[model samples]
Target: MSAAHDLPTTARPLSPEQRAADLRAMTEGELDVLVIGGGVVGTGAALDAVTRGLRVGLLEARDWAAGTSSGSSKLVHGGLRYLEQLDFGLVREALRERSLILHHLCPHLARPVPFLYPLTHRVWERFYVGSGIALYDTLGGRKGVPGHRHLSRRQALREFPGLRADTLVGAIQYHDGQVDDARHTMFLARTAVHHGALAASSARVTGFLTEAGRVVGARVHDLETGEDLEVRARHVVNAAGVWTDEIQDMAGGRGSFGVRASKGVHVLVPRERIQSSTGLISKTATSVLFLIPWGRHWVIGTTDTDWSLDLAHPAASRADLDYLLEQANRLLAHPLTHDDVVGVYAGLRPLLAGESDATSKLSREHAVVSPVPGLTIVAGGKYTTYRVMARDAVDAAVAELPDAVPSSCTEKVRLVGADGYEADWNRRHRLAAEHGLHVARVEDLLHRHGSLVHEVLALLRADPDLARPLAHAPDHLRAEVVQAVRAEGALHLDDVLARRTRISITVPDRGVEAAEEVAELVAPVLGWDQVRAAREVRAYRERVAAERASQAEPDDSRADAARLVAADLRTGA
Candidate 1:
């Protein structure tokens, strides 16, 4: 068969043993490409390269989506605000990507979400906002999702009873895509692995392997086992996101491009706090606020400001919370307070620097540069456009290869869980009944795992106790905790609580109450001893406490200090 016809198969389960094997494989021979950083772009780049039949390896210092990818507004849309800035091309590109994800690539993980844009002015505001929304709908085309619709104040209030009467004269409702960013990124890596890419998380790159003033591969430190390995590759692609500069320094000096970190914070409030049928979007003084619908909660966020502090933990200050609460209160009939916020999270965006002083004004358009003969660096793009960034980075890397490489076929590639999802969903009731579970529980698993949900179901069959819910957080099944370590690459308790499942951010105690129980459940799978399991539980508690303290701080510096109180468990703090 021609390499061009290579298609992804059902992803092999991302177990710890598989991760160790991947690291060993990278050291044995020279790979065509070595991807550094495991964010959306990094994993996406790995997927893009492997689909082209290139031998590829992916490395991450932390777990997948531990960086900016997981901490997003969770909306995949054409930049509605960008339309006002006249960045029509960017908007159109994002809309097309949004449509692709909604209908083709990851329909199981990504779904249509409606947002209401309230208009304050009677005449001009409606005409102006409606036109932009109409353009947004037009750009998205007719098939994937619904179009925009205009509503009067009365009709709008009927649709969204949470809106304050004085907030707007009318509203425009539109559709966009939403996803579980962390799981989606993990799935992307699994898809790459399925198509023959070596993938490992918690493997930190210590330095670049260089010869005769050219790049070769990297020296990596395995965090889990405390072992070091050398990885050799003809071409190295850096999709390190905000840490692009650090990776460049390891390579020698600053590559032709620069990235600036911008902090964005979000708070999760209980669903009943907002009596709305659809999500809410409105302009803030600096950027915008989105009230997105999470399962049993509403995520309201985002303050975009320049961040120069710690990249790993972007602290959400009291002022950040106040700003969001104040803005959200303006639109809500019932004001939300600090007591109402169940969880808070902050993430940093890597924007292309030197364009403008304001981080918000910086371009999200990614750049791929070949600073050295064997190294390629790609940075600065939104999560919605990661595939394009990945494609471009691979193209640049392939240009340096001595031989011709196949073109990117990732656009046609449906992620591992996407294939046969519709059929699986149609049989969800039958599957649920056979498994002795509710249909809604199966639906949740289907959305999280798609057609591969059968794998999770097999675990329940092997052990019936896996069917029980977590004592503290009932939304997730106990089997998921075991699956996180056994199947997905969840090494630490934090990985299971924070990313693999959203227990850390969904529950009011931030998974502290469930940490001990969940840790015990996963300990056997991960081979954690009693002492190690206790330490993991303690680390998670410290993390939650630090985040709480950080959120209480009045300013960024203070917040950063508070958050730093809990050093990363992976780093042995």
Candidate 2:
């Protein structure tokens, strides 16, 4: 392994200055590895490469985790459903990664979340489901969380009072992990930058640079500045998730495997709507439905069906919303209606194409293939095992290099906020007193930013006005808006509301009420004039309106058409 002293001494914020510097540095010299896509895996690959003492550059067409990464069920688990498919190895691997993420890697971002698996059948169901949960706990090595426990129908009712009496005779509670997927992915990108990787968002790879029919680099277009530049790299890793096939075409060759996009839609409702101490996960006919507990809301989802619509904006149709509601209503004592839904989001899963026509049955196993000498394409894996996928991609990219490269050391490298998280959490009350904030607010900051809460606090100290809570979105402080821009690389209003703070999904108006205030809050930091700031607020309102219209549509085609009516701020349609 490379010595720690060889890398940069301290971490740098993903501010505008750092972004401009990184973009210029990418063109000045040839990078050892250039990672396409700023989703979880791509950012992970960049971190892996940089920590291995390799020059790395990571580019994203939009904001980090703007794609499928931001729109996940937000669970880090062993895929308990996969064990029933008899894919024990995949389950074990995922479980191991889950433990690492919850315990060692990003403890602040990822943590234990318990779920109740209600059993309908009186005898056979209990035996089968209990055995599976047992195996799951064992497979994960019982490291980060506690073991599962079986409960009778009466006992289960005590734990989850909202469950219908006829739905299940008993329940088994098990532990998994949950995370804010967008923030976690952003942390990956920032950590990579800290480890000496040139990372930039709003930078799209337009084409591949080839010499002698071998891929050498990429032709990148800066979406923000509208300038085109060449980023040369000895090797490139395509971790483009759902758009993997399109990237292969740009490389002038096709890989051995094909990627299929499976759409998954999730709906967020107020926490009071679900009377459960723990989350609920029940098996559906096609796939499983998860009622994961977020801070002020319960995230219920999802449908597993083939989606060939807009790759960038996967719209959740009225049918999708109804399906989720119907599924959740089956177990709830008081059936939920469309009015209960606070927010809805749709995302595409890059499943590896297989013999089965069902997208749900497609393989979650990732494949790393080199269609060209200098390029490697990695696609199709669950979010929990991103580190393993990233490690494999970096391993493949380094194989072609002449110099002997160091192995990936990311397993031991904590994310930006992991270190001293426990200590900060322990003294959260003191922090709250010092910062002149409530203990609950300080605790929330600790959970979101971990030990890096101090950085956000610094912003509050610098500008006392930033400590005020957002008028419409009270859960998030105004300081978070500035922190998102100054540290987390948020360049647009959507980036802050949708990904950085999740104000877009947690609120009833889908952040429309908070959009103008948020846009104004970050305008100075982003160097946005009155015109630009107004444009951003207008664009955000249009986006919310388009999404609402899309959700009202009955099917995918109509929903996609409705969604496309609003032009993205970055692309302008």
Candidate 3:
């Protein structure tokens, strides 16, 4: 798949043994830098460091973005809420990055989305909001995103007819960008690898490798092969996000600073239930609930609260579910219930803990520290500013390197799909027509894969059999599954379902009936025998069943126990 786009090819099949050998070789060469964590920030750091002419390697315990990165609300915004707290520096920085991404980098992965912020009062409220939005526009250079437009009550009703007349006196419409967080993150990893950053997932970092009382590298476990690898480097940077403390403990440090995990949950409901083209941003008594347009579904969320649980897989409690429903229903014409919730996701935000009791007050400002001489830890930045965080992390590590590594140039390094996306996007119609695929379908692929759409289309062209849709989830084209395994580092069915395509939670059956077909598609690349293929498919189905069952459980303890069954099933596979 990657060959069509001229993307540098990874080995046809990525095996743990091959990965370990590569890591050991890089370490023996005494790498310039090694980044711990495979989330967006970590991957970004790898890209930044490598592009700056440093020999780099990245290690992740699970698949890319399996942690806090994939669990976000998926908005590329300047944290509008932070504006309320007078976080001018953060808002300005995030806004600049948001523009950089939408207008320059990853345009295909991130696109403009319109949202209406309803105003309950007229004169005073309008002036207050209008002024704030005006400042917001100035901060980002706005590009061409329409400046906030005021809408009268009747006009607002026409635009958002489903909203109760009592809810708003008017509205302010503005634009922000949204992204497929997991897909974009995967692309970052691939881009980093393309730029010569050694990237590996399903490889667990067992502990830090120290020399003379300083961390020099890490001892990683190849979960797939049950072997250990010692990767040595001059600088070890931690961009672990929420798992920052865990890595710090392995290195015998204080984590440089405290990190707090705040849980935010989102629910998916059918889009037809909401009668509006524009998304809605409403104020909750405490936080905010957004009813965003998510293709065929409306993503309504989220409840931000403190969480102390199995940080790996946070179970959304019964209370958490009810709280979200109660808040979101207040705006719906017909309130959503458990049945309307076809999918649910919970994400943890790794905020820098502050004096305030509230998580909302926690600083989104990121700090880079050489907690130990050889280790540079970066944490606490928003998604929009990931590139900036990465650049800073690489800069910190450069100071520790034995030889001076040139400054990061990733600010100009567009991701793999960014080049010529617009021109190719314009040609999508002609190409889709020639291929006998719907134009809308072509646009979807272009947006998701960007200029790399040709790579996926080539798979369909090579094998007409690959052009069909996934058996259960017709929304996803079959070629996409093959592409996921071949080029996108989807080594397992869970990787394909959960992050690569998000079919697991996006659909009601959690993609059970589609599992076998997906497994069949990936089997050729993964070299799985029939027994292993069947086991992969079955494990995915049980994972879905367990998640569905856990959601129905009355409380967190039951939900936690039930969720464990799913993990146990996957392990048994």
Colliding pairs, model 3: none
> How far is each candidate from the true structure, as Cα RMSD in Å?
4.1, 3.8, 2.5
Candidate 3 local lDDT, residue 547? 71
Q: Mind giving the per-residue lDDT tens digits that candidate 1 earns over 1-573?
A: 111112122468677778988889999979999999999999999999999989999999999889999999887878888898898888888888888888899999999998899999989988999998898888777558888899999989998998899988999999889989999998898899889999999999999999999999999999888998999999999999999999999988998879999999999999999998899899887988999998999999899999999998899999999999999998889999999999999999999997589988998888999888899999998999999899999999999888889898888999988999999999999999999999999999999989878777767777777899999999999877777777677889999999999998999989999999998887776778999999999888999999999999999999999999996877775
Clashes of each: 0, 0, 0
Runs of candidate 3 exceeding 4 Å displacement = 1-21, 568-573
TM-score, model 1 to reference: 0.97
Ranking by TM-score: 2, 1, 3
What does the lDDT read for residue 557 in candidate 1? 99
TM-score of each: 0.97, 0.98, 0.95
Per-candidate Cα lDDT values, in order, are 0.89, 0.92, 0.82
Estimate, for each residue in 501-544, the C-alpha lDDT of model 2 and write its tens digit.
Answer: 98888899999999999988887778889999999999899999
lDDT score of model 1? 0.89
